[model samples]
Each structure stands twice: as structure tokens, then as C-alpha cells.
Target: MKKRGSGILCHITSLPSPFGIGDFGAGAYEFADFLSEAKQSYWQILPLNPTNKRYFDSPFSSLSSCAGNTALISPQLLAAEGLLTQMEVEDHPHFPERRVDYPAVSRFKRQLFQRAHIRFQKGGVPEDYARFCRGNSMWLEDHALFTAISDHLGNLPLAEWPQELSNRSSEKVQLLREELWDEVEREKFLQYLFFKQWHLLKNYCNGKGIRIIGEFPMFMNYDAVDIWANPELFKVDEQKKPYLLAGSPADAFSAEGQLFNCAVYDWDGLRRNGFNWWIRRFHYLFRQYDFVRIDHFQGLTSCWEVPVGEQNGLRGNWQKVPTQEFFNTMLQHYPLFPVIAEDLGTIGADVRETMARYAIPGMKVILFGFQKEARERSYLPHLHPLNSVAYTGTHDTDTVTGWYQGAGDEERLELYRYLGRRVENGVNWELIRLALMSVAHTAVIQMQDVLGAGEESRMNRPGKAEGNWEWRIPTADLGEVASRLSEMTACYGRAQD
Candidate 1:
């Protein structure tokens, strides 16, 4: 039997707030309240990790894959935690309320989190804090220590740091650990506040029956503390240079193909501990979210490995992956792990077979479904297949309204035939109707589409670099979007208790 639901796909950082970007504070609660009123069951977000300054192509490619983006750590919540006063937080550099100025927000939030760290140091650690440290010692210690060293020495790439630290010599590591104990403590404290605030927000959503859709990216970024800290796990040489980075061959989207230079894993290194690292990752995520969405599910089936010196993503080659055995071993240890497979882009039969074997549902995108070229676009709602998570559009695509207006006459006409109705008027609502009426058990729509927003509300453009993950929906849009979507939820039989 299928468990049906209607969900909102807005990353937590996109939640409306007075601060530069949304944080896991009141904005989270308000969003959850809105979702409950709208009868939505899932709250999907992008990978929650510290981002590099490039304002890079995606949140999927992020530093600190396991840690929450310190940028999203709510300053308002800090005030509530007594780390800052309301006025101090309000005085935060007058940031544009609508978009995230990453640099500006990073400086201001760092200072605020520093204050929280100071307070934690002065107050001394709590028992729960110690327990959290002990419980998460494996990743937490390395991440916290990496953050401290990175901050103190300036955020240089791990490769460029002093040889002792960069290569992580046992003697050097021990010496540095003793020398920089205080800094490590401070970083850990910052993470504690983030975890504290985030869990509180997650609990609120859970109380309202909203399960978070936390993301799990396929690989870790080079600048990440994790990659440097666990050098053996990736295909990196003794100098920390990548042995074989990952990317995809030329496809419909990019004629040159997709070059994902992120570090690929060394299965032998992982196999030694019986994939204990992977198990630990899922365990931490399972505690934070009810369901985990594995980004680039295809990577696990068969990865495309690019030589380190490749000029563009175009020259990568596809290599067979051992994901079948990996999943088999992983599930044997942790069974009831609910996951959603992102089977977008060029996928192969092995990918579907793997997902089907595990009973993990794949994703169906609605924006990709609609088009005037009847034979061209397969994203139209009428073509949706069951056993998948459906979306009006993903974080990468333009909102429904944007897709409609930007599409040519034939594209719109094709949509008309697909929906058996005029494509010209109320395109957003019509698409929503088709999504709800489909065989998909779970349907998700970006908050942008809920308000009939256009291109500017788009989350990320696949190849474009900047001005992504910046759009914010006005808080006032919450009530109307919730109610309007609730009506659709009821009509679609996805209304939750």
C-alpha cells in the first residue's frame, strides 16, 4: 500500500526571516505551521552544509558535508539562547531581507556564533554537550578540529596548510590537538548551538507531522574538512591531490557533459571497516530526518570518473560502481532506512534495478513532464509513474509559471494536449491538478510555484554559477499558499490527519 502525501520543497535557508538568509528559528516554525495548515507532510531541503565563497553551482557541492551550514544557524535563536541580545542581533549588518549575501551573512553570523562559543566556554560544557561530543566523536571531533584550525590559520585549502597539519601526520596532529584545544572547543560549541536550535526546529515540525527531507550528497568537496580529515576514504594521493575525480559524459543538458571533480571514494579503504563511515553518516542523518534523499542516485550505480587534470566536464568516462554490494552491506546493518532516489538526468537500467530492489522510491519531476512537444518533454503530470516522489519542479528548475511563460507556443500547446485543457490560463494550478491526480504516492512542489512565481524564484540553474539559492518567499505568501495548496491536497486525497 502507498502512503500518499503533499509536500513543500523549500530549503530551510530560503525560509523568510528578517536576517539576511533564513535560519532554523521562528521562520522554521512558521513554515511548519503553514505546511500543517496546507495539509502537507514533507519538508524538503537541500544539503545543509557550509558553502564555499564561489557561491558555487550547488549546495550539493559543499564543505563539511556532515555539518549544518553555520550560515543557516539562526542569530535570533542565539538571542533566545542568551548568546546575544535582541538589539545586538538587530544591529547585524543591515542585510537585504530578500536575498542571501553570503559574505555579509557569514561575517555577521560568525561573530554571533563566536559569542555563543564564548558563552559556552564560560558557562562550561553541559553534560548533554559532553554526551553529544562522545556520541559523535568519530566525525564531530575531526570536523570541529578542522573548523578551528581552518579559522585560526585563515581558511586556506587543506593542501596548502603547513605540511605537519595539511598531511595530518600523527605526531603533528597530536601536537596541534594539544596546542589548539581551546579553538577546537569553541568550534564544537558553535556546532552545539546549531544542533540545539536545529533539533528544536525539527521537533516542532515533527509535532505537526512534517518530516524533513534532509539531503545526502554523493561526494564531499575538496576544501571540506572531512575530505582532508579522512584522506584515506577518497581517491586522493599522499599530497591530498585527487587520484580520480568524478564527472559525467555529454548529455542533453550539457553537450560537453557534466564534470563533477569532487573526490571519489576508495572502496578498499571503506571496506576495511565494513563501510563503518557510511553507516555513521546515515545514523547521524537518520536522527535528524525521517527520510533521506540521496542526491545523484546514478553515481552509486556506475560513476563517471574524470582524470584530475581534465579541462572541462566533457571528458569524463563512466566506470562501474559497487553500490549493489555497498547497499546490501549497509541495509543489512540498518534496515528501516527510508530513502528517496533522485533518478533524474541520464539514468541506466542498473540504477532503477538497484532502487527497485531496495524498495526505495525514485523521483518524478512535474516541470519536466509538461511541454507542447508531445513526444519531447516527459515531465508532464499525466505521464507520472507510481513508486516515485513527484515535484512540480526541483530546486534546479525554474518554477512552474517560469517554465510556462518561457516555453514556446508549441511547448505550451503540447502541455495543453497532455493535460487535456488549455495551457494558456492558470498553468500553475493546472499543473498542480495534474500532479495531485497522478499515480505518484508522494508529490512535492517548490514554494515558488505555490505562489505562481516565475524565473527569479528559481533555486539553481544547472550550469550557472552565482545568484543561486538566494531567493526568499515573503512571509505573507505563507498563509495564502498554505490554504490554496490545502484545497488541492483535499481534492487529491493527500490530506494528512
Candidate 2:
């Protein structure tokens, strides 16, 4: 954001809700009200794409980049819309409050969704639903068909499916569409409900003068509809299997590097097609969000290409992309690109140059500021550039308190010296204060940090596949921090007037 402002980094699923997991319901509205009370100007969230159990429900590994997660559909909203009865909405089994029970929640929500679909059909499909399908048919139709076929084939991977279906022969696809008309329609109906609810919440936030910041995932899942429908755009083999994957090369963090297991984009193929696929993706995202954060922004300059069958990213080579030409095309399509770059690890000069050329704000995390050496402490609040977006920590890092507790003695001493005070407790607030007071135009605090929560509340732990992306906040804790946050915001000249 160009304007000086502050916001909270809390995902929609992390909001307090009675329906096992959060959705676009009363809880979401209440959160927006809390932001207003806190004098915040923005609300940053993770990707809204659909997550899969196979991927440990991480938002980054989604079923479809274009489709909304059906599990996030609110039964409460359904009742209000006459799609279900109040009793039906409240019929869910008791779910844990502090963490999401994905399986339990999915089963419960799926049942309600089925009933709601039946009701929707009985009431006759509205023109709005038909119009939504028509508007998003570019991706919606293929996604729905892919999902229906996946379920019909007992969740078999597309590569293992019969040659006719995997290749998506026109004759086979037509027959499958006719045979599975009901299932296909059901999938489309779910998506219609998702957008209708999502936009309503977004409008409510906008009315309160708060803008939404959404993440644009860098890679696409191999099993996703986009890859299946447009195989030529990715590095897949003759049988439509991924031969090269996306990941990071071995660096200071890991000796073995990291294997992302996602499909790598063939930049040449994209360039040949005039980047039409990317243009469509950008158009869809801007329509849904006020600002889109380009995740893994370094990949735009060059990506570490890991060959398939490799256990890790050690042997991957850096493949360069036509960064200048790509952005030129994007600018021609959308003159005003409101984007933030996730320029975190090992950012090269080329990446920095591209970001500067586009005037895209890069990120700075306060948690990463406490280094043993002063030269390495560029993330410190005092060093943050005015164009940057500063944070206490991101979803990938531990909560503020957790980081403080786990940091080494030398780092803690450096932090104390930096502040000219040895703070024993409320370290999270100390960092929050520093972030807000920084020269950075925008500052964002994680909900966990705002609550002074510890390691147990950390959102995601990279490298650990399971038990991540399950943290949820208690309903009682939301309003408690507004007064404190408001005073700090006003003191730092970042409050919304």
C-alpha cells in the first residue's frame, strides 16, 4: 500500500466460528468490525484457493487456483439465503475450538452442501447462477469436470487414469459431461455460492474503508485442473506427468534444498501463447482482491528447476524467464498493478531491479531483524525502506513470542540493545510497536502475535507436512486487543481516521 497504514494477517479459516472451521458468516463480519475498531486500514490473508487433505490442507497447495474452497462455504449463510433451515445449520457435531478438524469439518459441511444443492435445484436455478457459470466458464467448466471425473474414478491421479480420459479426448469429454451432468452441475453450484459469499464479505470490508490483501500462489498443483487442461504450458512428459518441478536450491537454510512437488511453468510456452493464461489469472485475482501479493516473487526473475525423481532440490538449476517482456505485457493489459512482492530468501540484484522497475513493495519481517552481526540486520525496523511492508512475522515463521523464546542468547541481547531495553515479557508487543513505528508505508501483525500467543498458536511450520495450517483463534480473544492496537496505531500516525 502506498498510504501509511496497518493491518492484521489472519486467514478466513482462522476466524472464530461454531461450524468447526471459519467461513463467510457472522464471525467474518465480526472480524471486520474488530478491524474498524482497531483503526486498521487493511486485512491481509492467505490464499483463498481450495486445499486438499493430500497436501495437509495448506492453502499454498490448492486443488484449483481459480476455484474457491467449497469447505469454506458457510452453512449459516445458506440458512439466511433459504437454502437450508436453521436447525440444519446448527446440526454439526462438536468440533475442537483451537484447531481445525479438517476431516470432521469437511464431512459435516459436505452433507450440508448436498442438502443445500438439492434445495437450490428444487427452487429452480437462478439466472445469477447461470450467469456466474457463463462468466467463469474458462476455468470453471474444466475444473468441475475434472473434479467429477476424479471422484468417479475413486480419486485416482490423472496420470494413472485411462488414456482417453487423461488425454481429454473431445469425444470422451462430451460423453462424460452428459453422463455426469448432475455431478458437474453440483460442482458449479458450489463455486457460485463461494463467489457470492466471498464478494459480499469483501464489499462489507470495503464499506468500512478496509482493503483486502490476498496471496497469488506461485506454482500450480500437478493434479490441478489448470495443469490438466493446459498440459502444454507446464514441464510434463508425454503421458502428462511432471518431468520438472518447482522448488528452492540448497542454501543457508537446508543442505538438501526443498522440493515443492508442484508443476513448473514452461516460460517459453507461456511467452509463445502471449501469456494469455497468466493474463486471465491476473484478471480473476484483481476482481476478487484489492491488492494481490505475488508469492515467491523471485521465481518471476528465475526459478530453480528440479528434475522429477529427485529427493531434494540440491541438484536443481536456475532457469531464467523473460521478466522484462512478461511485465511489459502485463502492464499493457492492466496499467495499474497493485501488487506486493514476497522477496524473502536469497534475493538477487536482478529481482531487486525488477521490483524497483515496477514500484512493487517488497516485504520486511521484524522477527528476522535480530542478527548476530549488524551488517546482516537489514530487517530491523529502523532500516526498513518507506516503500516496504513490515511484519512481526509471516505464516511460515513462528509467532513473535515463540521466536523470542527460541532465539539464541546473542540475538536476544542484540534485540534488547536495539531497543535500549531488556524486555522480559510481551516481546510480541515490543515487535508490534517497532513495526508500526517503522518508516515503512504498511505494517501487518499476525493475529497470533496480536494476542501475544506462543509457539502453540503458530500457523504453519515449513518442512512439517501435517498438523500445519490448523491453528484457529478463540472468539473471545478477538475484541480484547482492539483498544491497545488502536492506541498504538494512532500514536504511530498509521490509524484510519
Which candidate should be chosen as best, given lDDT against the real structure? 2
Error of 1 at 318 (Å): 1.4
lDDT, residue 42, candidate 2: 94
Report the lDDT tens digits of candidate 1 across residue range 166-222.
775568877788889988887777777678778988898989988898897788777
Lowest summed lDDT over 10 consecutive residues: which window, candidate 1? Answer: 370-379
For model 1, the superposed segments whose C-alpha errors exceed 4 Å read 55-57, 371-378
On residues 302-363, what C-alpha lDDT tens digit does candidate 2 reach at each position? 99899899988888898898999999999999999889999887678989999999898999
lDDT of 1: 0.78
Residue runs of model 2 more than 4 Å from their true location after superposition = 252-255, 371-375
**What's the true lDDT of residue 437 in model 2?**
94
Error of 1 at 461 (Å): 0.9
